[model samples]
Target: MRALCWTGVNETSVETVDDPKILNDPDVIVKVRLTTTCGSDLHLLGGYIPTMRAGDVLGHEFMGEVVEVGSAVQKHQVGDRVVVCSFIACGQCWYCSQELYSLCDNGNPNPALTETMWGSAIGGCFAYSHALGGFAGSHAEYIRVPYADHGAFPIPDGVSDLSALFASDAAPTGWTGADLAGITPGDTVAVWGAGGVGQMAARAAMLLGAEQVIVIDRLPERLEQAHQHIGAETLDYTKDSVVAELKERTGGRGPDVCIEAVGMEAHGTGPQYLYDQIKQQLRLQSDRPTALREAIYACRKGGSLFALGVFGGLVDKFPFGAIMNKGMTVRGAQQHGHRYIPRILQHLADGELSTEHLATHVMPLEEGPRAYQMFKDKKDGCVRAVFQPNGASSTSY
Candidate 1:
């Protein structure tokens, strides 16, 4: 089996590895049909996320056909097409019952590893790191999906593979952010980062009844996508002050909801951003909260700010004052994909949601390294680089 393996900081390669076998009663082996790069993968590639080791498989967003299923996996069987959630969950757990699959108590096998950093383990994620469960990711020929009944959702008859691909991660993540923020009718929503998740968040805001949806990013292509596909008013953060423009657009009121989809690797245009960058590089801070800080500053009084971005640890100089003085609510979570994948699939089937545009580059799994390079550099408007393990025949769209 050929898979992308993380070897060191800023380095990865295709390595032929041993094929996965069913390890748990609820587990299933999936011949990966399609997988894609995520912005969060940049955290792993840049060596920001801790506990990643040499030869760790690296990818979380994927969908595939079941090649084998374990004894207890009754709902899924060989040849079943499914999109597995990024976060592993046991449906019977307390948190899972509450639809909080990302916080499932029974998911992480190595609780002590995350307990050291986060005080408690959240959930096991495919190919994130040992701290997050160390499950092999889907950027390979095949991947082992555990808790199949709980996390794997079958793609509907008419949903394209490209649409189902994002249900595995980005769409659910954006939906989670919007769902948690409690968007109401006529509310004004602003999303930072026009990447895959950000674009999805913008679209979700519209679907959730936000009267005005604004997407912020420096990338013109992404902003154009937001404008054309998601029907969002786009802002170029580099050209205009995000806070000022958002306030002006809202007629002196900031956005009612602000979503931060840009995580620890946020780039900045000023000294504060530069300071964060330097400190982060020196191991002085665990993340760059540039987008988060802006979200807080740009959120209206009594508004909500939701973080869908992946922040590894503590940030320096966060505006606790802004959150306090403005009476704002702040919340964040890893995507509880199990809770949202089904609904998103329906939206895809109904033509209410379109994520096919995000798949800007599609290639065979053998070009994994090059695809990642283009994705990382954001080259040629590469929003999401997708890989087809079985080549073109595996693609349904």
Candidate 2:
């Protein structure tokens, strides 16, 4: 087998690797058909995630066909096409019983936890390294699906793999963010960042019945995608002070709900002191915190602020005061992927939710480097790219 292996900061490539087989009766093997580089993958490339290591398989968002099934995998069998959940979790865990699958006590792709819970440590889903259980990722020819009954969802017969690809991650992640924001019919929502995740969040807000969705980002192409295809009002952050501007547009208070779609690799000019305080010493390098700052500042009193973006470090000057003073509710979570995958795909299959417009490019998995470059530089028409494994056929819309 061959896979896109992590090779330290700013490096990766397709390389030969050993084949994987079922480790548990609940497990199944997936022949990867399509995959993509998520923003979190970039964090690994930039060395922002300390747990990632060389030889680790990369990629989490994927769609594939079941090649083999463990003894207990009764619901799935050879040739069954499925979309993988972003994380592997036991459906029977205490957390999963409560719908908190991402934090499942026995859930994995995390080594220490796996060792603690299962009496030993083993790998998890592909590409996410040690901190995440070092599972071989979807950026490969094939990957092992642990907790198969829980982690793999059957793709409907006519649904495009391309369209359902995002149902695995972005679509559900955005769904989680909107749910946390407590959005209601006619609520005014404001979202930050216009990445694949952010654009999806904006669309989800609309589907949830938001009367107004204003998306903020500097990328014209992304903003245009939001405005034109997504039906959300767009704001170019580079052109103005987004915080002040959002408040003005919202009538002196602020938006009813604010979603931070940007995460730890967020960048800004600094005196070195600021960067050191927020990034180096504490380890959170994502700009989502800064967007959180804006969210707190711009959210209407008694409203909500949801940090859907990943936050990796302790903060020095976070807006604790505003959150306390404004009486705003704040909540967020890693996508409980298994919990949402089915319903989100139902939306996809029905044409109620379409991310086809968001996927701007597609190519062979061998083109990983070129795709990374396009995303890092925010190339126009490069909002998202899907990786089609050689000799594998899967449509991600």
lDDT of 1 at 154: 91
Q: After superposition, how far is residue 371 of candidate 2 from its true place, in Å?
A: 1.7
User: Candidates' TM-scores?
Assistant: 0.99, 0.91
Give the per-residue lDDT of model 2 (tens digit) for 285-354.
3333556676788899998988888765444467889999999899977777777789888888787787
Residue 187 Cα positional deviation in candidate 1, in Å, after optimal superposition: 0.4
Error of 2 at 254 (Å): 0.5
lDDT string for model 1 (1-397, tens) is 9999999998989999889998989999999989999999989999998889999988999999999999999899899889989999998988999999999999988789778788878999999999889899999999999999999999999888888999999999999999899999899999999999998888888999999999999988999999998999999988999999999999998999999999998987999999999999999998999999999999999999998999999899999999999999999999988888999999998999989999999898888888888999989999999988777653469
lDDT of each: 0.92, 0.79
Which runs of model 1 end up more than 4 angstroms from their true locations? none
Highest-scoring model, lDDT: 1
The TM-score that candidate 2 achieves is 0.91
